[model samples]
Target: MTMDGGRALVLGGGGVAGIAWEAGLVAGLAGRGVDLAAADVFVGTSAGSVVGAFLAHGGDLEQAIEIMSARPDGDPAARPPKPDMDLVMTAFALMYDTTLEPREARARIGRMARETPTDGRGAALEEIGRRLPSPKWPDRHLLVTGVDADDGSFVVWDRDGDASLEAAVRASCSVPCVFPTVEIGGRHYMDGGVHSMTNADLVEGASTVVVLEPLAHFTPRDRLERELKTLGDARTVVVGPDQAAIDAFGVDVLSMRLWGPGFRAGLAQAPAVAAQVQEVWAGA
Candidate 1:
């Protein structure tokens, strides 16, 4: 691994957890004698918690909060720097639970369609205007993106009924999208339900890297290992849900469970990771 000033890529940066990770990563690079640039896909609620976390993590929290509360820009990317990392975060913002009962996923989609496009994305606003009720009972769905349009560049979408919305948002976003995948004991796996991007596209200078994180919904440890073997000596870092899990991956795993303090420790160790990057290139 060659270390110069390569950009630090952050995937799944939509909520407080994402912001915290970005901040920690930034701080880590600084500690490692590296100048770090960062980005993410915000795809969740516009609640104060997300903004507050960004502020606490050294971002322009106030501005980010304002943009989210008011859909002032036709394109979210046009907004000024708030929570400005060295690089730009892209795609969706945060995830929210649209329905109380996830089993009734169809009903939740109906509600999303009924709501107005308070945020200014043309396609999303138009879709909501033409929505119809689902022929199902109390619907439940997972919200991978939020309705809040705080970021000027991103076109936020709700992953209510369609799990594929995750991929759609990734394809549309301005910044490279990072979709997490797991590897265990030299094998890699991607379940149909898990959101992932192709390495072929990314390797061609797409500016995206997928970092596998812990999921409450599913597990595929054996598959994860197979996937890593395919990388064949690519510089990869395994950020553990905790320090112990790091050992299981046989890679450097930064414990993510220690939200505030753990992040601080990780930030202090960034240079070690950045030093390993072989190239320093900019993304479009």
Candidate 2:
């Protein structure tokens, strides 16, 4: 992605701080000449709480509480630290549940996507997918899936050509799906060509765009290489696990702290990670 006067829209707000806060940070930086814009896509009551907190407090704790209190029967304990908000809380919570209710989560995501707005800037775009195809198929979903094995097997999905799918995946996976029309830290960073398209469209744009394994679906090593090769006309960066997988594909790769155990940790690390990516892109 080009790093000049771009935006970094974030989506989803149920589990972690959500994309809104990330968008706010980028916007804040952009306002000061950072060249970034951030947004959050809210999917439910929980997500509503996060978006409400950010909108009410401007990322300030005191303001967030004041806004949250306006909601009837709101619980203070549900609130995160001023910096620890994100959309992946639902995913993490689902992980802990013995039921492993992907279907329920899917339904909730559908509802949340429907409740959000389909147009406008920043948080508004999270609502774009009010009616998405079945998540089970690449044709129906925004991202594609691929699987491979070394000593073990894994899945991978790339956010290379389609930004909307990247946004959807970022929202669905609770990772911050940043964009190029946004800015952060006075530097400009963009999600390349994939910033405007959805993950489903992204799958169609690249070779081996999505990877599915026995238990999970995401970007795997071989798939990353294929995507990079397919994206010869543009610069690209792959985030998440399978660093070695990127190497396996002989693709230029930089690691960022966009995934891991929880939202708090990821939130704490995202700014720095984003900065690093920005720096690399600037130099390139």
Candidate 3:
């Protein structure tokens, strides 16, 4: 379970705001220009998978933050639920918008989700997935988790690459019925967080496990820790939004506000998170 002296960082799941909160942590790392040790396996579920893929490819912390931190200029409520403007979004815009404002991004993702398969492959999906992580590289031990919608089982990675890899990621990021289910190898899939927020079972061969979580403060923090304790033989650390921050988000059932402009307050905490990461690394 432990990588002995090695360390692994797992970006935890968040729907809309979770990815933004993770972006703040990444922004902090970018500001410092620091790097974690080698042989670290990065595991992410849902929004975490979207961000973790970049870090796995040795993505720039600051640049990644800029993209993940996308937000509308004013009231999210003011934004169009169904815009009268052009539905067609450029690749760059679609890339970030999907997670930033998932409602809108869903339209963009919807275009590729049901793409026509050519000889058992969805060409459009392949093209979109390939462009996700900037400056792509090989031999990166990356795992993007998803769920098979038919069976409600996890569709995490194994020998992933190209459009198929992107398909897996899109499936993991897909919101059930919000965005259409994505097909890979003839099977449809949905978000992996439907099972567990952390999905720490993907963590292996690391002595230290660092998780970035954006769950509400009212969530069972201690019980989650206990569950991680049983997952593997490693030191686990979970960092997430505090009670005050969660209260500020004012989460409510079936509300778009939580994942919208209200999430900006969540981004405000990035700097402090960087400090905490630094301190944790120092102790390690």
Best by TM-score: 3
Per-candidate TM equals: 0.32, 0.28, 0.66
C-alpha positional error of residue 58 in candidate 2 after TM-score superposition, expressed in Å: 13
TM-score (C-alpha, index-matched) for candidate 2: 0.28
- Model 1 deviation from the true structure expressed as Cα RMSD, one decimal place: 16.7
The per-residue C-alpha lDDT of model 3 at residue 250 equals 56
CA displacement after TM-score superposition, residue 40 of candidate 3 (Å): 1.1
Which of the two, 1 or 2, has more TM-score? 1
Clashes of each: 51, 60, 2
- Candidate 3 ranges with C-alpha deviation above 4 Å: 1-5, 30-39, 61-131, 134-138, 158-163, 216-219, 231-233, 243-267, 270-276, 282-284
Ranking by TM-score: 3, 1, 2
Which has the greatest lDDT?
Answer: 3
**Ranking of predictions according to lDDT:** 3, 1, 2
lDDT of 1 by residue, 188-230 (tens): 1111121221111122222333342322112334434554455
In the range 1-284, model 2's lDDT, one tens digit per residue, is 22232212212232222222332333333334433212111111112223322332234422332333243323322221222123323422432344645445333433333333323223322322221222222321112221111111112232333333323332333222221122222322222111111222222222211111110122224433543464443433333312322222122111111112222222333454466445434433
Q: How big is the positional error of residue 50 in model 1, measured in Å on the Cα after superposition?
A: 5.8
* Candidate 3: residue 33 Cα off by (Å): 6.4
